[model samples]
Target: MTPLLVAVDVGTTSARAGVLTRDGAVLARAEAPIEIRREGAERAEHKSENIWASVCRAVAEAIAKAGADTETIVGIAFDATCSLVVRAKDGAPLAVGSDGDPDWDTIVWLDHRALAEAEEARATGHRVLDFAGGALSPEMEIPKLMWLKRNLPKTWQRAGYMFDLADFLSWKACGSLERSQSTLTSKWSFLAHEAEGWPADFLTAMGLEDLRERASLPRHASPIGHPLGTLTAKAARELGLPKTVIVGTGMVDAHAGALGVLGAFANQPETIDRHLGLIAGTSSAVTALATEPRPAPGVWGPYFGAVLPGIWLSEGGQSASGAALDHIIRVHSSGAAPTPLMHAEIINRITQLRSQCDDLAPRLHVLPDFHGNRSPFANPKALGVISGMSLDASFDGLCKLYWRGAVAIALGVRQILETLNARGYAIDTLHVTGGHTRNPLLMELYADATGCTVHELPDADAMLLGTAMAAATGAGLYPSLADAATAMRHASVTREPDRSRRALYDRDYAVFLKMHAHRAEIEAML
Candidate 1:
């Protein structure tokens, strides 16, 4: 019997598990939604127990669906959001709430309630802050921790372990406390580009020196491929699998998407130098492979061994993409609660209506940075701006504004690519994967806006496939991540930029830039 590998991807909204063959074919898959609750601007949280339950359910469902011999499963790999997870010494949930129920322990990555703390840390001029786009936003771990320390002092004092969601999942399954280089270097300011461990002074400066003594953390590549002992008997039974299955170290969810696609393309003869991976989901990230580490001032990383091992990665992205679009529709409404079904239909109807216009309209321009800018200029205080809006309250008009926002996001991506290209990083084609890729208008807009062809994987589950590939490696089926990607990844369609829309986008991009600059001015004034 052919051996199978398991890949579990824990995302912001869902947990997915897939059973796959050595050659990259997915035999069965399962998905479970991860609950999210947002309190206010930049405040998002998830229950750790809920997340773990989702993982177990997804894995069990996938195994049952595959109908394969359970003993054939050789290895498992995991991936999840870079969100922060806090637990007490005995592994009990430690609430991070200011005054709500004392059960919320997970701080969703989108949570920016730590903005004040992050800004204060930035003002300290810590050298470690340079790796994170020259400024640390509340999105990273330390600031969030600091917020907990100041706002939830009692909880902070009692907390025994803190983890990036990806690492937390790994620990839960195999009892390994090793951290991924992808997770620490990208979000926790761990030095991957350098040969040393975490900078002592940097931690002290950020008022997080206490973590320097933590015993559970492991370096990026040190504990990389070791089986974190087999899945615990408890985790195994919960997942409906044998306890002896090997569990390998995992990666950040987007890096898993990159590992699933870009890792493979980097080795290909045709797409090596300039290929970029756009993982568009709740947020958007632009990932590119680099030969050596090169830092972009306001963008994240030059993270070594973060995505594909040994190759450097420079990541640029919008802090909000799909979420921003959702916010756009919600707030633009005068006095209406847009149901999920209604909201989606509104977007579709708007998209179809926009298709009827002459492909050029001056009545819409939207700045979708409602969650603050995450790339090119690491300003977390940046606000969204809308221009060219008429008094028209029609849904079609709303859709046009929505499309303009999407187009503006693409333009922002182009700006990052331009920055990278200007600084000597070559970007040739874009390989995109994620939930937003399902939108034809979004893909076309991105291609036209960036003047590059957009290639999406045929599988539609690149993140899961990426994790599965890692399992394939741990099972000794593939030599490396690059090898796994090539065998498993398949391009379904390529969307090329249209010349007619190119000129219109060019003019519109200028206005987009202007609107952002004006917003900055207004924000500073306030």
Candidate 2:
């Protein structure tokens, strides 16, 4: 049996697997829905067992679909959201929320239960904050860890492992406790540019001085493409794959998608800095790499080795984009969220309505900070606002709102680009992947709204192929990730910005900034 590479991506809603040839051709892909428990506005959680089981099922299904024998799966790598996973010293899942359900061991990346803690951490004014866009968000690990220590003392005291979701998968696959450099540098506030990596003084200031020791973290992070070890026998048996499979250090899922999208430009520095990779889904991440560090205010990073070795990466995004669009549809007078059929109908409805007016949703505007502003304003307290809502509650009204919502999401992307550009990046092109690519309106708005040339990934599942590239690199099929990615990248379809729509979006962008300023005014008055 010839060896194959496997990529596993654990997203907010599902666990997906791709079995691919070494050259990056996807042979088979499968997905399994995982469980999430939302306990009000502040908390969201997932069962570790459910995630792991879903991942195993997905991998097995993919291998079966590919008709690849278990022994032929020679290399495996994982990428997942930056959720926090906690386990007891004996390896049992521990509760992360107030429900006290031990199975709910993962704090989802979008959870905002740590807002106060995040603000407190930001107040520390530590040097580490400089790397994290001069301020940190509730979404980061430190704030979440601080929240656990304060509110769930018993769980925190009993926990021995705190793995970022990606590292959790790698550990589950190979029994290696090493963390990924990408994960540590990007989310855990490890100062990758510094020789020491972990900022001990910063952690001490946050009262989590014992985190590294308690979590059993390695003194140094393993680079993204570094091989961890052969798959453990238990893991192999569970996955129904061969023990000979090599495992690689993993990264934040969006970063992996960025790697897949932008890796071809690795050697071309001038081209790389001008191209941003947008991986949008339940949320969105805009990633750009620079050979020289260029720290932008409110954008996370200038993070060294977060995306590629020796390249500094900066990330900016909306805390909610696709998710916000979904929420708009659900809460509209139209009632509950549309089923896939209904959503498609809504897209059709929007398209038809646009035919009626050259200026669809022209007066309507939305600030998509429903989940808090993750970047370009590092503020977690930001709330979403919708201007110019009419009293009409008909399906037509819903369509108008939906159209504006899509435009707003793209406008959010535009705002982020401005921040990046101001800080030294001249991004005139955006490579977009993920679920957002499925929405025709968003695809158009991204280019028209941002006035940037857009490239749609030819692969429907680029994240999976990206993790496959990592597996190939770790397996020594490619000398480095750059080599593997360049070899594996697919052709992209280009979309030039619509000059005709530019003026309309310019007015919308003005309203977008005004909304922020208006928000501040109201807050001060309150």
Candidate 3:
């Protein structure tokens, strides 16, 4: 029988599953939406029950679609958003809300209710903060945990398990409380390269001394792609897989996407550092691989062994790329709500608009930090800036706005690449995956604005494919993740930068930087 692996990607809005053979062929894929509840502008929550249910449904459907025998499914792997999942001692979901809604048991990655807590965490000036992008953001686990400890003491007292969503899924599947190095080092401030991994004194300084034991987190994190254990009978039945299936350690979804896109170059070892992974979805995560730790100011990482062992990863991205675009369309005078059809219509119109005009929104400029800057600046309070807008509320105006917004998002990438190149990375090639691939305009600007060769691989689900590679290794199909990555790397359709437009983008990038400086000046005055 042909060995197969199931890779599940639990994203912000959906749980997507793909079944693949050991040789990188995606047999079938399926997705199911996971509901998010937002009561306040800063509050976003998900029910772990709902997320796991979505995962199971998506996996079952994908397996059925593949028409593969369940016995042949030898391993499974998971990658999920860095959401914080709270559970009671007995394993029931613990409400993270004041209303005590069990359905709101998880705090989402983008939730900013912990903004004050993040600031407080940063104020501690602990050594752990150094690993956390030189400052902490509300998105990381520690701040969210601090928020729970301070605001919901009762919930905090009752909560026995605090799982990064990925670890939660892995534990649910294989009955292992082992966290992944990718999850721990990248988001939870567990330094994988360090001997003690856990910063006991740091947590104690924040009065979160019990967090380590509360999470039931092991002393050491499992390496990415390592098999933790076999799936429990209950999980096996729920996922429609065989009991023989081993479950591999999981990672953050974007990290997994990084693995998917950049892992292909792992065999090269020499030039992989020249490649960056731009995984865009509701939010964007810009992942850069490094053989050694080269920590730069304001970027989220230089995390050791976060994606691949013996390699460090630095992450920089816009907090609001897709969401910014969605907001642009929703609030525009000429636009209705943003639907798939409307988005496609805008994309189609922009194609024609660019044909007529050399630059669609040459005068229009956008600062796409609406949800705040997640990279090279690490300021969560950052706001979006629009330089050109008028009473022109025509549909054409909206398309132009969308076009400029897309370019600005790409320019944001340019700004990060500047910082990356300044630090040490010779990032000439960007391997892009996820939602940005679906937008032709964004894909084009990714190359033109950033002046990097864009590699868009087969449009297959790279996150799932990356997870599958891990699963394949865990199932004994390969000796290590490096070998699996080498075998499973999918070829890409390459797009080179339009060098002729370098002058245009250089000017735009200048304006982008000036705008950021201006915003900072105004904030300083206030």
Quick one: best TM-score, which candidate?
A: 3
Instruction: Name the candidate, 1 or 2, with the larger TM-score value.
Output: 2
**Cα distance off (Å), candidate 1, residue 309:** 1.4
Spell out the clash pairs found in candidate 1.
274-428
216-281 per-residue lDDT for model 1 (tens digits): 456444323345668898888887778878887788888888777686674763335488888887
Q: What TM-score goes with each of the models?
A: 0.90, 0.94, 0.96
lDDT of 1: 0.78
| Model 3 residue 181 CA deviation in Å | 0.5
lDDT against the true structure, per candidate, is 0.78, 0.87, 0.88
Q: Which of the two candidates, 2 or 3, achieves a greater lDDT against the reference?
A: 3
lDDT string, candidate 2, 60-90, tens digits: 9999999987777778999999999999999
Error of 1 at 475 (Å): 2.2
Residue pairs with backbone atoms closer than 3 Å in model 3 (clashes)? none
Q: How many Å off is the CA of 232 in candidate 1? A: 2.2
Off by over 4 Å in 2: 97-101, 334-336
Candidate 1: C-alpha RMSD after superposition: 3.0
